[model samples]
Target: MKKKIRIYQSINTKIVLVIVLLLVFVLQLIGANFITQIENQLITSFQEDRKVQMDFLESTITSSLEIEESGEGSETSPEQEISSLLTEFSGSGITDLQVVNSELIVMGTSDTTQQSTVGQLSDDVDLRQAQITENSITRQVIDSITQNRRWKIVEPVFSSGEDSQFLGAILMESNIESVYDQISQITWIFLQSSAVAIILSLVLANMLSRALTKPIKEMQLQTREIAEGDYSGTLKVYGEDELGQLASLINDLSDDVAEAQESIDAERRRLDSVLTHMTDGVLATDRRGKIIIINEMAQSMLDIDQETATEKNLLSILDVEDDVTLRSILEKQDDILVNSRQNDIPIILRASFSLIQRESGFISGLVCVLHDVTEQERIEEERKQFVSNVSHELRTPLTSMRSYIEALADGAWQDPDLAPRFLEVTQNETDRMIRMIQDLLQLSRIDSGKSMLNLEIVDLTEMLDHVLNRFDMMIHSAEYEDKKYQINKEILEQSIFVEVDPDRMIQVLDNIMNNAIKYSPDGGTISGKMEKREDTVLISVRDEGMGIPKADINKIFSRFYRVDRARSRAMGGSGLGLAISKEVVEQHGGHIWADSTEGKGTTFYLSLPYFPYEEEEWE
Candidate 1:
């Protein structure tokens, strides 16, 4: 398992190992430096001790010369004493010692081997070439004089006496045994420390690897949980460090994942409900051209009579590409289209997409939906047709009336008897056409929703009185002929003020009153009455005239739609009277209706909201 992990993993282990190896290498370098220092010091000490011994021996030889010059035991054999002294000094780091004289003759030596003598008299050929003057020391590795198995350190020496005289030179040859011993100790120390350090470093490396890998291992586990769609918080945090920050970020990511999952679930449920209830069709597909899901409406639309469209091809079922908008939206990573089409129908559907990314941030899948809006489009078309028809009907009559009026003014008035009736007829025709035009203009304004009404408080009683007086002359003239022809009005209360457009209210009442007068069938009673209710005031104009049938009641207020077209045309109905009245009532935020029994009478009621309905206005 360990080998497998290393093979498939990144180089984290390698980096740590490299760092540890560098540490061990530096330690060994330090140890090597310490050993080198000890060796240099030892070598210097050995050389200095040898030089000191040579100096002491030279001083002893000089003392011997002085004793001889004083003539005290002058013949006591100087050679023997010098030889003994030199032999003793030979036991030191210097293996051999010799003294040479100025005569270049044989001098007392450290050994009686004759070849160990410093001068030529001893037959020591190598010793004769040794320097006699200019004191200097040098070391050489040559064959040892007494030992056949090793080499020696040969150091040359000179006396520091008069004439730099040849009191004789001192030569020392050191055995290589001590140098080998010192070198062996250093090598042993290097091996020992190297082994100990390697073992300790391995232990530390293992521990350090675990310390660093532990947090990352936890992170790997958390990442696996997230990948498996288990977003519950399980991140392990240690302390306030880089790794701690990573843990915090992971925990935050888990929370975000949970929230995202909830949002997706909610959106899914909402989408499902919408698909089930909506009259439109919905379809979803994946990135590789495979169908993911399809709603019932969509299935039915595409002639697919199954419970689902899962694992199918969308294009195979939905051969129609009329929904270009939805298709374009589905083509993007994420998009929304408000208007999409169907095969043979125009639809406005809202569609959106979400790109699915994998571990490497590559595209994975796609989703789509569709909707239908055919019925709503048909209804709107019908309304537009109706408006156009109404316009035509109103315009035709006005056009004809204007033609005759122009004709009558230009020549029909030339004949006196013909001219009087013609001009009167023309005036009435003009008046009728003007009323139609005025009604048309009002209806047009209402249809266009452009008419702004200036509303104010209106006293119903005062308004009625003012309207009654406008026809006072006609009322008074007909008093002698018939009392029934005169207008009659009744009021139940005073201070009947309401919020209304006064002029529009007057126009509505005028239209009703004119219709009453023109189509009363015969002399009849024209009566007006006001009734107060909890929230509104009702104004009624009743006349013994033709009554409207129940079947036409619903359409009575439609523009250019008249009941009893022949009688309405004879009575000079503009066909927009009730329509304009309806518009005016609605503008004041009120209502108007008619109540009557055919051939009995007609009563048009205008209901208005009290200016301050909530207030105790009745008081």
Candidate 2:
């Protein structure tokens, strides 16, 4: 990764560069103005000095000319007298001097190099202009050959009289190199001063930039730390400035964010706890129906691992049809029944959907609550079957009674034997229906927890003997004489006492014995055994006959359930005997179960807790 530049360094660099550039520009502008002013002043002074020198030279030459003209005995010529004065003035900073007459001829010269050209016409423009205009003229020029700057001044010399005729012009040229040299020296000094100022400005700018950007850089670092979830450090307030205020605000913001995060984390933990411990499965999806969150129950219910389920499309995992998307369910606010299977056992889940929406009324995602309703649905189906079975059972006996009564009503009573047989059949069917109804009422009472056992300590051995003897007497009678049913008893010799309602216990024992007799073949042995265990007395009834199938053994104790429904109904069995027996056993703090094998006999086992009989209580 490329390294990041620090904010302070960048800010500092830019600030310093801008300040330095501004300083350099302003300083240079001042320096240029100052130099130009100095050069102009120096040139103006040099021109004035040249004009003064020329005026004095012109006055002296005219004085000499007038004095010589007035003196009859004067020997000096006008040109020689003027040349003597010009020579004196040329030595005083003048580079060249010349005297011109009215005819624009060079009358006298102070330059030795040009002395041979005396009496030559003056080719100087200013001198010719002075002669023509009769006015003094001054101009400055640079010498082409020497490349020296010079100023030229020309003045007309007049006669010393009232008429004052213009005699000639005096022209003088002086070098101004010294003034240029001074101006150059001053410009160099200004440049040096400007360089020093710029250097000082740069140093100060760097320091100032540091001062300005140091706090801002600290704030930047603090903000970055805050972003990474650290709100421990605070920036030092350097001054009561905008940056300082900003730093304070950032610190405040950090505190607020930390507090908000803590609250959010706490809420998240609470939600997680609820999801973890909830019995129902909960699933959350995104707007696109991708799974975002799935709790443990959801994972277990869907038989999916978290790693495989997360971020996968919800519809794909659910294997729902196209029309049953999470969004559609949420929008319709409907509960869906999802049918699935685990371990080949059908599972039914009732899933209620709720929409997750934003504050702006936009749907963001969905939440589904899944409840396992398999057991409930099975119970509902069983209840329906029970009602149907009850109706069928009642309808059969009623139909038989109705047919027999109708036959009697249709004059069967006139045939005495037929009418009597028909009447007997009706009476038997009525009794069977009455028995069936009584059994149904008893079962209803047991289910509603309204049947209470009257507890009494009694010898279980005597109870078993009493039930067996009742069957034995029935077998000995003429009704069962052709089919031999034998009772074999294996009673515990030691008396085992138990606390139970004697009537209910007898009812249970009778039901078991009757069932054994009903399923046993002719001459099959029905065995009864009473064994005392460590904590309870075990009473079991066994039959040697065609045994219950393995698959029907578990459901034999259910109400209206029969191993052979047709045979059971033909034998006047209500199919609730074992069910009632079980309820009675359980109500007495005992349990009953069956052990059966195909092609072998089935043993119905009843366990009752032993009671230590006190003599007084037994009495």
lDDT of each: 0.66, 0.85
C-alpha positional error of residue 181 in candidate 1 after TM-score superposition, expressed in Å: 2.2
What is the number of backbone collisions in each predicted candidate, taken in the order shown? 1, 0
Candidate 1, residue 72: lDDT: 63
TM-score for each model: 0.41, 0.66
**Candidate 1 lDDT tens digits, 334-415:** 4333443456444544344565567997655655555444565555765685577556655656576667667777887687
Error of 2 at 73 (Å): 44
Top-lDDT candidate index = 2
lDDT of 2 by residue, 271-344 (tens): 99999999999989898888899999988888888889895877787777665855467669788788876556
RMSD of 2: 8.7
lDDT of 2: 0.85
TM-score of 2: 0.66
